[model samples]
Every structure is written in structure tokens, then in C-alpha cells.
Target: MNESAPQADMAEQLAASSFNTASRAIVIGGSMAGLLAAKVLSGHYEEVVIIERDEFQERPANRPGVPQDHHPHRLQDLGKGILEALFPGWREDLLAQGAYEREGKEMHLISPLAALQFPYEKDEGCSRPLLEWVIRRRVAAEPRIQVLQGHVAVSLLTKKAGSKLAVSGVEVRKQRSGGSRDLEAALVVDASGRYTRLPEWLEELGFGKPVAEILHTRLAYSTRYYRIPDSLKDRYSTVLIEGDPSLAEGSGVFSPIEGGVAETTIYGAGGHYPPVDPERYERAAAKLIHPMLAEIIAQLEPVGNPRGFRVSECRLNQYGEMPEWPSGLLAIGDSVCNFDPIYGQGISVAAAEAMEMGKALRKAAKENGPIREHELQRRFGRIILPAWWTIVVADLRWPGVTYEGSLSGRGIRFCQEYLDIVRRQALQGGDMELFGLLMGVQGLDAPPSSLFGEEAVRMVVSRSKQDAWLEKQLEAGETLGDFLERSFPVFHPASHSEANR
Candidate 1:
């Protein structure tokens, strides 16, 4: 099969159909998620309007809205596939606009135990601004989509539909003029991002607030851009040094971006924040588990001063759990859930959500049925669950991290320990398939349960008796079966056997 075949098929499916679900759809926010949502909405609506607080420029540049644009950002392979389908030739467009093509052979992952070279396919390397710019250009070219810049959505305009309030439109305000106006629409999607006011708006509209699940890791990172030396250009394009959870230190990335420059971000979880001072930043980089990043930093010429960003918590607003949801309204992207940037799951998850939304809209248009807001929200929740859990489990490894949600501390520890063994096995045993499975689940391309497959369980059980960490747990009177039963009741070995039978 041709590699481009899937993209062609997806592009054909995304093309506007003769049947229309609504006259107009309004998307709140004009970032990556909002833009993708608008692109999806364009297929099923006559007109799609994106309301953004930041004004767009012809060239790619950082804006105030995306404060973390200065740092390194990655578009996961799954997300790249989705975007290629959404806008054909987007990867080439990015390269034409100065993005770098990083092949899998150029990617390196340095763990506490070992350094692994992943021979994956080629992926684009660019800053967040350029990625957003390329996608914005694609959305701008779409005839049915209109981006309303310098405008912010103030609140939802709703009307009574039986017992529940149905969103009719949004009250938007001009950021410069401070003037407000109402724009009517058949559908309103909130992609207003991590600091969304949808929960407050819902409460004001009498629907009550959704439960907010938060995992606090207090992660902080400082980034500095450097011109890549000519001698090192042929070296590894990306190097990710994993942090030691016990020490809450030694995490950093060296990524080559566009404009012949590379961005290095040194980060720490728990309370150990990377400093913004140039001297201290170097010190932090030197202290990392690997010296590659620091050595490269010393060799490259600095392009800019160090900039810092902090993420105190990862939040998920459980809008699906609401007793009643307003019709003609939906939320996507960071409005639904936002993860720590280190995982690089945000853009990919948002793209997946938009793709799913497109599929649902197509189905609703074909059936001439009303869109089920609550059901759709629940489906989006399912899409976000694995990514959220990945971040939660990973973050819990660091000292001083705390999670307030469904999973208990013991369960989190079990997951961390299990994954630790799996990771060690994958790296030390040279099990590429197992490594890929672990990465696929983290990348949101595979379900989390894939990690609990028969092969994985066998490895875990067999390795546990010999592994020092697992031996400690076993000596503490907890068997592997007991750990599985306590940590994952629904996925106990007995249940696994029963299901297989």
C-alpha cells in the first residue's frame, strides 16, 4: 500500500459534502485546537467563524496568547498524520517555510539506565509559532472558514430549550475597543484553552460547574535558543534526557528548529525549578544525567536570553459528568483538558478530537439528526483519558507531586513500577516492539490497556521475581497478582484469563 493513500482517503472524507448540518458554527479561540476545530466544522457548516484574541501576521511569529512558544514543541507522529490528512502537503509547506525534517535515526532518548536510538520515520522540526502559522494558513485558505482576530468570546448567549439552556451564540468583545456584540450561530465550540471560563459560564447559566481533576507537579523549565554549529549539524537532531524522579532533576531536551537554530529546554519537576539566569541555566544543564545538551549548548552561539515557563498543574474539566449539558454547544482542546507540555500530547490529542468531531458531524448530517452534546463530550473524554493518565502516572514519579482524582496513590505507584520494569526491559533487552508499544500508548495512538497484554503481563511477572524493585515489593508481602488486583481490579490476571477463555 502507498504511504500517501491514507492521507488521500482522509482528505477526500473531509471535503465538504452536499448535506449541511448547520448554517454557521462558531469556534472560540484561534490556536491550534480552535483552528483544527474550524477546519472540521467547515465540512458540515455553511460558515465557520474562529474568534481569536491575538491578531495574525503574514509571517510566523510568537504572540502573547501562547506564552510558551519560545520553548521546544513537538508534533507527535499520530498528530502529524492527522494534520497531513486535514491539510494535504502541510509537511512540505512547513519545510518550505523553514522547518527542519528530522528523521527517526536522528532521535535519541536518554534514560536513567541507558540511551536508546529510535529508528522512526521523518518528522518536521519547528517552533510552536511556525506550526500554528502553517495550520492557520491552511485554515485561512478554506473558503468556508473566517478567522475573527482581536476578538474574545466574553460569554455564551443561550436560550431556553425545554428544561435546559441551549447555546444560541456567543457574546464577543473587541480587545482594543472593549465593545461587545452577539454573533448568532447554530453551534458554538469552546477551544479557549487552559484558562477557559466555560466552567464559570456554565455555573452562571445554572448548569452548575463540572468537576475539575488536577495533578500538581509544579514543573518549571527555562529555554534558550542557539545557532546550531556547522560541525554538529549532522549529529542527532533531537536528544531527550529523561529526569530522575527520585532526585526530581536532570530532564532536558535539545531540538533543532527552523532558521538554523536549536532550542534547548531544561526542566525540573516537583519543587526544583530551572533558573532563567544564563549562568545558572548552564549549571542546570550541566547537572543533567547526560552531558550532550550542556556540551552542545557550550559550543553553539546564543541567539536569545533564557526564558522560563511554569506549569503548576495539569487540569481536566469533567464537563461530561454534568447533570445536564446545553445544546448547540461543545468544548474541545485545552477547554476539555490540558496536560504538561513535556509529554507533547496537547496538539496531537486536539487534532484527534477534531478528527473525531468531523466524523460525528458527518454522521449527524447524513442522518439529519440533532447533535448529542453530552454524548459527544463523553466521547472526547474517552479520547483524552489515556493521555491524561500517561501524564498523571509519569508526573507522580517525581517527588512532591500530588494527584487529586479517581486513582489512589498506591495505584499510581503500581503503574509507575510496572512501567519502570517495562521501560528497562525494552531498553536493555532491545525489544523494539515493546518499546514501540509503550511509546504508542504514550503518543495516544494506542490504548493504555495494550500495556497489559499477555506478553507484557508475562514479562512483568517473570521479571518481577528477579528485579530488585519488584523483589522489595514481594518481600513486603505483596505478590504480583495482589498488586494487579489492588491497582487494577478490572484488569486482574483472573479477569484476563476469563476474557481469554
Candidate 2:
């Protein structure tokens, strides 16, 4: 048998089809990442196909593919902006579906040290199912995109292109019936998420497996829904109580979702898992740093039993580090870098990546050449770096949490200490500028380096004497600001004035 016969046949079939193969793209998975990817690809491709393993309903509801859908999820301001650009009136659509808008003042952040209220332009309080369903609906309306639910992408079909393997299409299998078929495309995106088999698929094609960076957080979440009491309905819409690592207590979030119900999720790291039992869960909530979360939980009417989800580790597949990558293949969202759910960074990060993908596609179209998959992967690495580092620094503070990656423990510890001082100063001094910057960084709206401005450095350095490591770093030959700029050079450092704005 001819080795190139399969590739030749696929090419012939694509040429004979109505649409051009060069203008077709396939996205694996139908979740947030996949749906967003399809939306972006629709602008560049004539036909965009989404292969999803789980069947989706016309209405919003939890699905098996997204186990954490029942838990509370947040869309950061940055993500909201991108979604609005992709799907006009996105927030309005969410509002029409019972989601309420939450202003900065309506949200509260309480920690053991202090309580701070930061300013945010706007955010929506909604369930993960509602968010995904809204975006999926927008994507479904795009004539160029076709979502094929209950279909699993089993493997990638590749053909040799020069010295590299070019992904020609995807081999998909029907989830319900034991049937399979090949869907040829000019590009293949692996947005199948954290459990993605892209690494295995690449290895099968003789490409060495990408290095995996793991952070074993051992985080657990127990969430229970409640009906907002009439009296409490006028209270704050969202409250987040920061977990104390010293006491091994997890964070708690109380936010209103659709259907006039509020979901409270209590999460802890390093095996400090929240309980699923009603009584035990309330007890755990009572032990939070602040009593506000517990007080609210007591007044709300319990809607459902407490449900739990556990994350053993967060993984980032370093595909860009590979010496050579397939020409026509790319990965996005969890398939690239999966974040800790506790941070609520997954959906926002996916939306941001989709926007970047769109820009890359537009550039490729202007140049009239194939998209540089390797360079695009490197760009995504840059995008994921700050978010990855932010979570790494926080998770490392937990007792049993450990990381295996290029980041050093010393650097992580230094960042943690620096952030602690900043938080204290922001809250105690009532520095809304500093607090807003902190929130912006955490929300993935601003670069992590935004927290290292001159003003922030001065504030942190003044209190650095307590920590020996920070003292040593401050006393080094280079300026404290310069040291941070060199130490964690993920994003360009923001100026104090720029950060304040």
C-alpha cells in the first residue's frame, strides 16, 4: 500500500467537495473553549465544525463533560469585554436569561487581615451552564459553524509536509452509535480540555511528547445552592472570603446565579477539602476567616445537597517548547494550560485565547499563508504565563501543594510575601488604586507585572523587613523594582501611573 494514499485520497475528496479544504477548520470539544474557538474561527474559515463528546440540550443545564458546571463560576471583566466583542449584546443575552449584573460596590472581599471593596466596571452573576449555553447559542447562530454534539475526536489524521507532519483532519467517533468517520479540514484545534489526548496523538505521529508542568494543589470544592431570602435579596450580590493558608482554611464564594438562586462554594487547598454533608458544610463555612459567609448561608433556603469536586493537580502542556510541531495543528484552553478552578480563571482565559486566535488567523489571511502553529503556540504560552504564575504563587502557600516546573520555589515564596504586604497596605491604608490593581491582576485583566510598579514596590519594600528572603532581595545590588522585573519577566512591567489608571 502506498504510504501517501490516505492523504492523497483525503485531498481529492476535499477538492471535490463544495467548500474549499483550505477554508475549513475543526474544533474538538463543545465547552466554553471549543465554542469560543469556533466563534473566532468562523470569521476566518468558511466551515467550522465542533466535535463534542457530550450531547447538549437547547436550554442551560449541567452536562457530564463539565463536571464543575454546577459550581459557581465567574467571568472576569477582561473575558466579558472579549465575549461582547465576539458576540454583540452578550451581557444583554445573559441578563435576559435571569443573570444579574454586579457592580464593583456590590461585591465584597473579606480576608482575615482586612476587608476590601474594589471597583470593577461590571460583572454578571450566573451559573457555568448558563454562561456556556449563551456562548454556544451565539456560535450556533453563525452559519459558518456547525456543532456536532455526541461526537468524540478519537485521533488526528496527519500527512507528511516536508520534515513536519501536517494535521489534515480529525478522526471522530459517534458517542451514541459505534460509528466513526474522518472529517478533513485545513486546521485542527484541540480544545478538548485538561484531559486532552493531544500529547498522546502527537507522540503517535512520531512527535515527541510535550513537557507537562504539574502543580499538585489537592484542592476541593463543595458547593450548595439556595434560594435567596426576600430580606437578603437586597444585600450584596457577591461575597468572597479569602482562605487562610496558615490555618489551612479554604476560600468561600457566595454569588447569585440564574433562577433567583445563589450558589455558595467553599474550597480549600492541600487536602483541606470542604465537606459535602449539610451540617458539616455549614460547620466548615462557620470556620471561615469572616462570619459574613456563614451568616448568609444560614439565612438562605437550601435548594440542593452539597456537591463536591476535587482537583488533584493543574497541568500545563509545554507544546511550544517542542523543537518541532505539526504545521496545521494547534491546542487552546485547558488543552494548553488548565488552571485551578478555585481561581475562576478557566472561562476568562479561554475567551482571551480565542481572541488571540482570531487575531492570528486574520494576520495569516492578510499574509496569504498558512498559520504558523508553532509561533501561535508560543504566543499562547505568553498569555498563560501570568495566570499560571499567579495561581502557582497562591497554591504554593498551601502545606502539601508542590510544583514541578521551571518556576523556582524561592521566586514563588518571594511573590507570595510581596503580595501579602501589598494586600495589607491596600486594605489597611484604604488605597483603592492599589486594591484595584491587585484585583485587575488576579482577574486576568492586567499583567501580573502590573503589581510591581514603583508605588507598589515602595509599599511592599517598606514592610519587607519581616521576611528574611524579601529583605535579602531588597538589599541586593539591583533596585527592588529591577530585581522583580528580572526575576519574573513574564509580562512587561507596568508603570506606576499606567497601573493606577
Candidate 3:
């Protein structure tokens, strides 16, 4: 009799545990950010729901949610690593789906300062849609997550928590019928990207608009798909010809995608625009410092007419600085900070944000007992700020982009001098490691500190033999700042009034 009673007690305990494991979480948007967020949420929430506006296709293809999918997007080493961590073998899945290596094509980098071949990481190079779809399948397979497509999140449902408001659920509307419904959850995340309506939602909740720092990229990009020539495949090459700021052209990229197809995107800043017409695009590529892209275009057959995307500015929303920051809702990815698309930082940054959120939640659950919304907000804000700083610093170099000047003039000169040294070193001696390190920093695989290390400094100092031309500028009574301003005039901030005029 005592044995039977003990067995019954164990059964009751099991039932209780099962009941407690059903908590819910909701993530808005089903893009990379949202998928990554849902993957993280699955660890903490018993069930996670993803709300996506676009319908998913069986194979990877461009969707409406991501307007720039038509253009080439590479998963940086950091982003690829993060995806691998989230989905143990996502890289393999992508490769199996025709994702090729960065080395699939011969590559060349033509900079104003030097001409070199950029070394892309081995496990990278996939179309934007293919990468997203691969991750989507993994997220969908998670036992605790559910994908709901063709529904858009209209507003966040919040409840009064003491003097502050907390998000409790989301109100989503069907894309076709406009039918609406509310789904409750313990937490809500916005990863809706550049087209997010989170700003309006916050205003409706009585929070004055958040402060914003805008960097006017004045950038327009056009891409056309191409079928690689069989002769070129044995030696298919990708070329990056950076725009000459003095000439008003921004940048041109010819990348080989997985399917023996290449994407040529000519981009520009200021008033110079990427050509949308095929013949004009050829003219634009011909004007680049290098003739590789133009030559390649001649050999390849065009897949479709070139498509163009223009982004007026890159905006950083200071949501954390809001007078009354609300709990229950937080944003990640392009929703919080949309970088200029040329950098290829969006996917990586989104992955980083999602991973950080997961770590914070798990840590809070173990050590802090329960998550404090304000503290969570503060921590999240801090986690993303460094990466944001890195991205903005690079973007600010363009005259059309804006920044508040945390990076000083002297610092700019130091960077200019350092880059000049590295480029010179790479060109003179073909110091692959030096170029690789700079590329790594750009890929978010390493911090800028990596470039200033003793080895790097020594290599540049030894190989560069000192830049005589730059030294001459300094010798001619030019300040460090003045030298940089004169040499790379693009970095100097533009006058809005003059720009307008």
C-alpha cells in the first residue's frame, strides 16, 4: 500500500512539471532577425510563435519583406558562426542547397589607395533568400516554435505593471482578409526591419518619439543577375571597385552567387546614382578604377533586367533613451539600427543581438531569479552599442553620411595613416595576413583592436617603409586632420545647407 502511494505521488509531480512548461513567447517578423529571435526564445519559452507577413516558399527565393534580397548578401564569418551556433549545422544545409564558397570565383579588390585581392572566409557566400530559408527551416523544426506566415503584427498588447506598462501579447492581422486576433505571450520582440511600424506603436502608447541619429547615405544600388560563362567558371572572378568620391561614384561589386550566377551591383552616394538601365550600368562599371568588372560583364549573359534600391539614410533609434521606456517589448536588427546595405552587417548584427538576448535571459533566470525589464533594456542596449559604433564609424567616412563626432579628427587621421600603411604594405609585399586582418575586422570577426596589435604594427612599419607621400603632406604644414581631410575628402562631414543648395 505504501509503495502504491509513493508511485502516485511521482506521477502527480510529473504532471505539474508538464503544466509549467507551456509558457508562451511571440516574435514579430519572420526575417533573419525574427527567426533568430524565435530560436532564442524557444530556449526560455515553452512555446514560441513567429509572425511573418510574407508567405514562405519551398525553395529559397526573394520575398516582399526583404526588399534588398535581389542584391547579393554575404554572411560574414561572424554571422556564419552565429548561425552555426543557433542551428548546429546550418552552414552545411546551405552548402547542400547550392551555397558556394567565397573562393568559388576569382576575386579582386580595387581601392582608391591600393589594388588587392580580398580573402573571403571559406564557409560563406550564399544568396540572402537561401540563407534566410535555411535558417527558417531550422527554426521551424524546433519543437517549441511555431511559424505563422501571411499575418502582420499590427500592435503590441500591453498591460499596466505598477507605474510602467509591459507587453503581454501581439495583435496581428491577416494579410488577405484583414482578420485580426490577439495572442498573449510573456514577451514580445520587433525584428520587422527598416519598414517596421514600432515608432507609431510607441507614440500611440503615449511615449513621445525616441531620439534619433540619422546618417544620410544618399545611396542607390542596382543589381542584375548573370549566368557565368563556362570559360570564366574555370577562372570566374569577382571584382570590387570602390567608387572615387572625387568622381561621385560610391562602389561597384561583382559577386558570384551559388548557382553559377553572378550579381553585379553598382552603387553611389551624393547625387551620383547607380544606373538602372543595362547599357548605362555597363558604362558605370567601365568607369570604375578597375576593368575587371566591366570585362566580366562582357562575358556573362544577363539573367533579368537590373533592379534598383535606394536608401535615403541609415537611422539609429535611441529607444533606450526614451523618457519612459516600456518593458515587455524590445527591438533588434534593422528595427533598432539599419546600417547602409553596402556593409553586409545586417545579418551578422541580427544574429549577435538574438544570441545576446538568449544569454541574458538564461543568466537572469539562473542568477537573478526574474528578469527586470528596465535592467534587461539597459543590458541589451549596451550589448549592441559596440557593434553599432563599429558600423557607424565606417559609414561616417562617406561625406553624405552624418555622425555626432564621438570619433575625433585626430583619430580619423590615425585611421587614415594606419590604413594607408596597411594598403601600401599589402601592395608592396603582398602581405596577405595584413589584408586578411583588415578584412576580418570589416567582417566583424575581430575587433579594430586586432589591426593595431604589435604584429600588425610591426609588419606595416617594416614593410611600408613609411608613406613618403603622406609624410610630405604633414611636412608641408598640414595638420593630421587637414591631411586626412584633403586626401580622403569623403570622410569629412558634408554641410547640410551646402548639400541642400
Candidate 4:
């Protein structure tokens, strides 16, 4: 055989061998979701390639892909636990890098009527970039996982097998070289985040795109970083300075970050946008849902000019409604659902989804005959929907936010009743464990049902009359729903839709 003929035959044979290896998978996007997907796929697939359109950094730093990386991030205790389970000793790695293990920062859960500071039994958090970078490094160390940086996934390669659409592989293009290559794999995962083009691609292939449920609460965020003075590090702990939702203002959090620095992010809901200047940042902080944030910001040094970001509420991809989904393909993370970051639950939910994906993939592998791709997608959706409801519903209660769902009348009353309990409990300072538990559930450590349990509801009712602070606030004309409607009309559907709807 001539040199050219033999080489062509070898290439064809290799391509054939690549399909059934039972050890190869391709993942699109090298984000937190993508990296976590690779870690989960490491045990199941012998080799996993993560393709990214952005340049990959050896160290964890800010990049164009994740615009919100610079903002404050709180890895709820549940999220911390999930990461610990995923990468053993991950927390220790963070602690070693000057990431504070906050334990005694009393949580102040606020409502229009009252702000209750509870001595939390357990709570912790860290910077967003530091946490993402740490996890990315651990994932990259896996021998089976290889990150193909600066590459874009042009399209997914699928074939019709009998009556099923089987995902055979992916077509990718290298950014620097402008060269194209096709890689065959047993599975392909889409973790391309909120800007994912998967739905559009599916439409091009004749598959109907999944409908999106959007909660449009026109919100804007401005964030600035500060170096925490050594003396204030221990005394100055995490504080969730909030905006009075009833007042048409956004909420903010001032917390300790990874590099011995503090970060404050102020968000405005509806049309109450925070100006990208120091004076407006302070004014917004002072007038937030609670006024304590103003006191905290007054003591900090400005590390950088504030950066602004605007968001149009939350988005949930109803993948479960798809008529037909190809086997061996999965969507994860922000591509699956994106929640309002103000709730501080995004990281934890992502971790929870990753854990679920790992379990589903393992079960599929054990069955050996066929993969339950639809079931896997359903399982992922099940994990996301509850969190989505919590966030979208909360935003919808405000003046400026709008959504497709019915949130007026009885819905508004139900939310008001729930906040009534939240206000009372926050005033009495008697439900730290419960508050922590709710945070975990919101963070995806537990279910939403945990928040509305008989015990929690009873506690709210019992404390409603007894909370002096709440009673006083109510007497002073501060009701939860009224306060929210007045302060955050942007998140309130009726306020934005009355004229246009």
C-alpha cells in the first residue's frame, strides 16, 4: 500500500473505533458548569474534551465569558458541602488561599416590618472568581479530562438510528488556527451558560426549540471591590444589606472576598438603577431594603471603580416539554436555568444539578443497553424548577418585574402571607437554624417544601403577634407587599405591564 492510501485507511479505521470506545465524551463551554461537568464525566468517560470559545486561563481570573465573576458570591453552606463532596479537600484549598471560613456572622433576614439578626448556627462564603478558579484547577488535574481552550462548538453531529436521534459527536473550530475538526464521542454535554445557542441549533436541525419562561424584572447591578483592612477583617463579617423591595430599589450584599478584600454589589430592580459612581453607590446602599448596609459601606475603602450590569429578570428552559430530544446529549447549568443572583443561590443550584447529572450518567452506564436521555433531562429540570420558582416568584412580587405566570390576586396574597412569617421570624431572632435550612433548600441542598413545613408556618403565625418590631412597623404603615410594590416596581409585573399589556 502506498503511504497516502495507508494513512487514509488508518484515519477511517480510527474514526470508526472512536464511536464505541465507551470512554470518550465532549463538553461545550469551559465555564463553572463545563468544568464541573468534566469532573463528573471523568469516572464514566475515559477521555473528556471541554471546548471553550474564550481563551483558557491557567489561573482563575476575570474573562469576557463570565461578566458577573467580579461581583460578590456567597457559596451557601449547602453549596460548600456539595463542593466538598465533589472534590475532597476543596474547602481546605480555599482556606489555605486566604479565603475566610466565616462562622459567626449573624444573618439579618429583613422584611418591610422588621430586620431580625439571628445568630446563625452555621454559615460560610467566598469570592466568586476564587471559588470558580479553585474548582477549575482541581478539575483540570484529572488525567482523563483535557480542556481544549479557544475552540468553539459549531454544531452537534447527530444521526437517525431507526426511530431515535443519536448524538454521534461534535464539530468544533479552533479559534487561533481557524481549522475545523470533528470528534466522535459516546456523549456530548452543553454547559455553554446563559448565552447558549443550542436551542437555535436544534431549530436548524428541524427540532422545535423549547419554550422559555421569562420573569422580566428590569434590574441593574453595580459592583466595586475593596481591600479589607487587617483590623476590620475579623470584626467586619458578611452582611446582606438589602433594598426595600416595596420601595422600588434593588438589594445589595457587602461580604469578605478571597484575597483579603471586601466586595459590595448594589442592584436596582425595575427602573431604580444605581448610578456607576461612588456617591450613588452609597446612596443606594443607604436606602436599600434595610439601612444597615449604608453603615457598613461607610467604613470600607474603594478598591476600584464600580462596574455595571443589567439583567432582564430570570429565564428557565422548559426542556421537559420538548417533543423529541436526541440521546447522548445533555444541557447543564445556566443553559438549563438562570436565576436572579440577588438570592445568592446560583452556585449551590449549579452544584446540585451537577450531582444529579453525575448520578443519571452513572445509572445510564450501568444499564448498558440504552441511555435515558429524556429522563436525564427531566431529572435536571426537576432539580432546577423549584429554585426557579422561588426566585421568579419573589421578583414578580415587586413593581418593576414581570413574568408570564399569574402572580396577581391570590398569588400576591399568598406571597404577602409568606413574607409576613419571614418578617415576624426575622424580628424574634428565633429561627436561625430554620433560616439556614431555608437558605440550603433555596441553595438546592433540600426541597422547597422544607420552607413551607407545618413547623415553619406555625412559627411564623405564633411570632406574628409577638414580634414587637414587626407590630411597630405594621403600625407605622409598613406592610411587606406594600413596601415591595412601592420600592421595587420594576420586579412587579403589574407596574410594568399595566400600560403595555
Per-candidate TM-score against the hidden true structure: 0.89, 0.91, 0.82, 0.83
Ranking by lDDT: 2, 1, 3, 4
Candidate 4, residue 358: CA error in Å? 2.0
Which regions of candidate 4 are displaced past 4 Å? Answer: 1-21, 105-111, 118-125, 289-291, 405-409, 426-437, 453-501
| Structure candidate 1, residue pairs in collision | none
From the highest TM-score down, the ranking of the candidates is 2, 1, 4, 3
Tens-place lDDT per residue, model 1, 270-331, is 87788899988898899998888898888889987899999888899998888989999999
Superposed Cα deviation of residue 465, candidate 1 (Å): 5.2
Clashing pairs in 2: none
Number of the predicted model whose TM-score against the real structure is largest: 2
Q: Which ten-residue region of model 3 has the weakest summed lDDT? A: 492-501
> Against the unseen true structure, what C-alpha lDDT does each candidate score?
0.79, 0.80, 0.71, 0.69
- Candidate 1 lDDT trough over 10 residues, lowest sum: 492-501
Residue 266, candidate 2: alpha-carbon lDDT: 94
Q: On TM-score, who's better, 1 or 2? A: 2
Backbone clashes in model 3, listed as residue pairs: none
